[model samples]
Target: MSLGMACALASACCFGIASVLQAVAARAVEAGSASGVDPVLLLRVLRQWRYAAGLALDALGFLLQVTALRSLPLYAVGASLAASLAVTAVVASWLLEARLSTAEWAAVATMCAGLAMIVPASGAQGQHPGPAALRWSLLGLALVVLLIGALAGRFADRPRALLLGLGAGAGLGVVEVAIRLVESLTSSWRGV
Candidate 1:
């Protein structure tokens, strides 16, 4: 694979792990609350320091994602981001001092397999898209993914989040593939 593709795949792996961490962190915050407490209320309950720390972690994740995008294709970046689930799992295990159950591992495995299928398998077509098209397409796909994820939020839980996040990730992967294909076709026609 080319450096760009490798970066994208690495980013996807990082993203998967990060997602898992976020899940673990979220559950911790939820579990820390008193009985019958609404999760929405958890933020208010968190002291300023706690909130800041959480926000910092989120910022860190964003930074890593952006960095990865610089070296990878859009689809690669998206797939890596979907990988946030794997990240969440690892972080949860370490922070909570627990191991993922067999069922949870199985679910994560399935998600990773799906991600592999979505990411581009070839590196020969290392075409770069124009800034405008890349921006608009990514924005559109992101909006759609978030919209779908939000719609799924009503059914919030680890499993639901994992599935929804993967759905969003797949959307991103498809966009990248489309972009690469278009770039190849346009470039070929120009050559002709």
Candidate 2:
């Protein structure tokens, strides 16, 4: 495998492992009295070793992701990132002693298969950098995501969580596209 693909997979692994650690830490902590999204609870969770480790891994994963993006097409990189769910399931089963249903196992297998198929098909990235309009759109999307997040606090727990998840997913997409738009890592500020 190429170094870029390897980096993508490693990034996925880091993210997957980080997710489990964060979940464990989040679950272990007691709920705070804050009515809305509790910033204080985040500070509290930061004290947990698992959570801290998870954050560190997330940072590493992001850096590795950028490295992967330098060589791999965005589609391949996105697939690799999605494949992190497989890692998460396996790690969760092992570390948390959680049993996976047959369906879940099958899903994980499918994700792996999809990623395997994508790797060979994902040739080199195209030469075209994203247009100025696309960058503007990303900025617009960012604002929309921020707005959604702001309004999400009004919903009950389940709906709020769902809204936040959607917003975060959109935000991630913006970042992914923005990374592709940037021509140079050194001039990242101007790129974004």
Candidate 3:
């Protein structure tokens, strides 16, 4: 597998688990709250603890992403973070005692299949920087992702948590693309 693909898969796996952990922590906080209190107020209090934990995780994730970006291309890193939704779904269900609908399960399976299909077989040629086609493709895909995530964010029950996951994914995607462009420019400069 190409370095880019490996980086993306790594991002996906790590970010997925992080999302789930965040969900689990949130559910635990909610469950531990007492009755007859304003949820917003309780949540503000809870943020003290949850945000601290989240910040630590976020720092670790950022470091990993930076290390990955130094070696991988843009698309790989972005796609890996896509697995965050699946991670979130599983984690939320377990922590909140929520049931997963068949549709959600199907979505998770489909995502995995799609990732598998994009990944090259063993010993396949490493990905070359393509023409404008690949760049436009990535741009178009990013736009579509943003639109879908916006729609989902609109109706999300835990909007705060959900938005964090979406934002993190989007941010990671953009960072990867930027890193790839920077790497290309530096490479061309050295060649000149």
Best by TM-score: 2
TM-score of each model, paired residue for residue = 0.46, 0.90, 0.53
Best by lDDT: 2
What local lDDT does model 2 show for residue 113?
90
Please list the residue runs of candidate 3 whose C-alpha ends up more than 4 Å from where it truly belongs after superposition.
1-4, 24-51, 121-173, 183-192
> Model 1 off-target regions past 4 Å?
1-50, 97-99, 106-125, 131-192
> What tens-digit string does per-residue lDDT give for candidate 1 at 1-192?
455545555555545454444444455564534543476655643544544455555666555555555555555566656666675675667766768999988877887787677555623334455667766776777677777777776664776778687876667565555444444444579998
Q: How many Å off is the CA of 104 in candidate 2?
A: 1.4
Candidate 3 lDDT for residue 141: 63
Clash tally for model 3: 2
What's the best-to-worst order under TM-score? Answer: 2, 3, 1
Model 2 lDDT per residue over 1-192, tens place: 788899999999999999999999988888777553566889889999999999999999999998898889888898899988999999999989999999999999999899888878889888787788888988999899999999998899999999999999998888888877877757667667
Per-model CA lDDT versus the true structure:
0.59, 0.90, 0.61
Clashes of each: 21, 0, 2
Off by over 4 Å in 2: 34-39, 186-192
Models, CA RMSD each: 8.0, 2.7, 7.4
